[model samples]
Target: MSCTETGAALHVEGLCWGPRPGLTLVDDIGFSIEAGSRLAILGPNGAGRTSLLRCLYRAVQPNAGRIAIDGVDLWSVSAREAAKTIAVVLQEMPGDFPFSVRDVVMMGRIPRREGLSGWSELDRERVAHALSHLDLAHLAGRQFATLSGGEKQRVLIARALAQEPRIIILDEPTNHLDIRHQLEILDLLRTLKLTIVSTLHDINLAAEFATDVAIITEGRLTAFGSPDAVLSPRELSAAFGVTATVHGAAASGGTRFSFSLPRQGSLS
Candidate 1:
């Protein structure tokens, strides 16, 4: 698959993973995202959305298949090397850290720091830029644990930005935020230059935010393509086991969706 001319290209083929024998959580998933694109993975609970992301971000090694970043096998590179190109924002935040916000963001530079030399001018500059870009500069001195959910999420994203990676991977980025914060975070993601890969439960948000969408269910990829093609009523109904309807065109402002559970003992 061809990605955009900017950012990094990511390709996964025949990806499969599971904890041990006789069980598989991710099965033969394959897709590619070009640079500067957002790919949203959607599925019901326990449908392996998180497992797929874990494989992509190297949090867990796939039992089979290959992941290539910018045309190089991900496994061929060291963890430090991979960290230079891929940054990750997880769903959970650290319970408590005595460090201030600035200190938290500075940690992103750890991958780039040379042995025994400590942080350089570039590190400081990137951290400052990230803080300003995320509008967290005003809160830089605040204790991390004391911030609101939205602020904490932004801080985590700022930390990812400070890494200066070509691709950023997140798992359920909007999970715990309120409606306003959800939109804020998604809007922030749209402005970023990096390739974005994330899992979201909200189908409408995925439709609005993603350049491409992949639907996974039962550890398999059910659909993959532009949202217009992949997010049809049929696909949604099958993947989510709901009666799905699409309203409005993507070009006419935005596409919206509504879903209801299928009637018991009745096939429509």
Candidate 2:
């Protein structure tokens, strides 16, 4: 994704939302992301990481705030126009009927296509490129429903890649997967060179793969900065109420995060 370093590749200002009493789920939260930077949103469940993403994606409306891409307000354009730049991959890829892996990914092209010309040569080129980039070429002809958890996750990510979106939002992209596939997916994300914002359950993975990490606590953004700066022992313990240790990744020659046994309190 091409962008200017004017503060961030994506920007959010005064973003807040909730229902019923409509409590401020994300209170006055704001940040900027540079182009080609990766940010990992880390917190315990219900910390509002996903809610913040929904607001950015224009899925659920914020009670008040301005969300901008490059510098334009997202609400100023129609949903289709917004979609032309944003793509998302959630824990589950939602669809009712059967869809070929290739077909589902090609659907990403619809946003960029002009009227009824069908899939153009350029579109096919993009699909093939995304498949290869994602290492999903072998599964291109497979049915989406028949794939395992890890394969399905990668396919969803490939579909997002096919969109050529400027900003990619992934919520728990590694919900169910073996250790090897988990590392593979994380490594792939590290090399994408796009403006990526994702919510990850594994604090270690967040630290390892992200250039910057944000710690959201009780509906507010509590910490934001480089992994070494933010994911310290005190901060990790306070945020998740767990014991954790940060060290070198050993194999990758980078930060490696590990959890220590909790002394007390409910396991978060």
Candidate 3:
């Protein structure tokens, strides 16, 4: 499957979500993801990142605000149509599935599937190509459960790529993977000219991988700009309760941030 060479615009305005009549988990949030650009949403745990992501991916409906994809309101888009355009590689990986690598990755082809048929030669080729990109071609027949955490992460990413999506939404894409795999995934994302919106735990990684950083604290956006402009020492201390120092990475041409010792009980 392929998308029109059109740019995918992910626009969100005044988006809000939560349960019951009160206690808003996310409130009056607004953001935009332009064509072929990447935005890394950064926040501490339970800072409404997951709630915001759920709204973005239509996992949950927002009580207020507009989320549009290429001028189409996200709520109006059919689930099947949304599946073809936006694919998510969520933070939580699926378990207890006794499927082979090929079988799992082939699920990406579900959008194009008609009723209850099987994979065609083209489908197999697409799966193979996806595996090859992640260097998992040889493990096509291997059990997904037997693979390492890093390998499973890559397989999940491959599945997302197999969808040929115009926009990719990831929730902490580097969570359980080792340093090497983390860098590899970020490197791949840097080269892909598709619109990407993701939640990230590592502020340093976001500094390197993201074209723009959106910092959220207590369910509100605090800062949004280029890494150097947004991830300041002051913001770092307040946002994550850390004293961070940013430095240049000569090899990747990206900035690296290091944290200093915290005061006994407070940030000074």
How high is each candidate's TM-score? 0.96, 0.89, 0.91
lDDT of each: 0.91, 0.81, 0.83
Instruction: Tell me how far the alpha carbon of residue 98 in candidate 3 is from the true structure, in angstroms, after superposition.
Output: 0.3
Q: Would you list the rank order by TM-score, best first?
A: 1, 3, 2
Which candidate wins on TM-score? 1
The CA lDDT at 67 in model 3 is 91
Better of 1 and 3 by TM-score: 1
Model 1: how far is 241 from its true place, Å? 0.9
Off by over 4 Å in 1: 1-6, 266-268
Best by lDDT, which number? 1
Off by over 4 Å in 3: 5-7, 248-254, 261-268
RMSD of each: 2.5, 3.4, 2.5
Candidate 2 per-residue C-alpha lDDT over 1-268 given as tens digits, one digit per residue, 9 for 90 to 100: 2322112378888888886465777777888877778889999888989988889888988888888887888898888777767888887666453999899889888878899888999889989988999889999999988887777878888888787787788998877778888898888877686788899998777777888888999888898888878988888888987787777654475766677669666455
lDDT of 1 by residue, 17-85 (tens): 999988999999999989889999999999999999899888999999999988899998888888888
